[model samples]
Target: MRIYVNEIKITDDSIKCYTEESTEGLQEAGQMLVDSDNYSFAYILDNGQSYSYLIFVQETWSMLHENKGKKIIINDNLELEQFESEFNYILDNIQGNLNYGKEFVSVVEDTFELE
Candidate 1:
């Protein structure tokens, strides 16, 4: 399917929500956050190393699939090059990034259908 960076915003009521950035300003439509049974993520350690992790949410929590998902990576010890490499790899192979740096964040669009 298609993937795009769904920007996160703080609502007036003090809640986090996702919005698409556009010329017309923020269109804070409802987001789809899914708790997938088959998903993988990575964690960057303090020593500049990253370890990948996988999670299975089961079909019971699968209803969350209708909302946006967010993943944030933070590590001051990691170099920009290493961070960028990992970030790009995740975006291209898995999802796309909303922000990148020592604190790389991505809002994934999980549209892949598993038959």
Candidate 2:
């Protein structure tokens, strides 16, 4: 599966994920990823101003996973078409609920300087 972070796309190569059949299973998978130190996960979040591309790498997953439903703001945007394509791809490939409301891919928002 793929995820859009602003204009950038991230795929499975850079991340390790688990697809579960139920929300409970999904939560368990997320918890497993969070407890481990060798995996990372990505999510897309919007906080009014822009969408945030957040990633949890190595040991960082635990902290983020603790506040599961909270919104953390990061500056980013994504193309609707690309996001949809990736979303569909995940549904097609994974045999589960797969609708955790987060993208399977991850990207960092670009920083710009005003002239």
The TM-scores of all predictions, comma-separated, are 0.23, 0.24
Roughly what TM-score does model 2 have, to 2 decimal places? 0.24
Error of 2 at 88 (Å): 16
Model 1 earns a TM-score of 0.23
Clashes of each: 9, 2
Tens-digit lDDT track for model 2 on 11-100?
Answer: 322222222211121111111111112234444434444443334453433333333233332222122223323323432333222233
Best by TM-score: 2
Model 1, 2-106: lDDT tens digits are: 122233233332212221322121111112222322333332222124222211123211222332132221121111224334534444543443333212222
Query: Which pairs clash in the backbone of model 2?
Result: 3-105, 6-77
Estimate every model's Cα lDDT from 0 to 1.
0.27, 0.28
| Model 1: residue 4 alpha-carbon error in angstroms | 25
RMSD of each: 15.8, 17.8
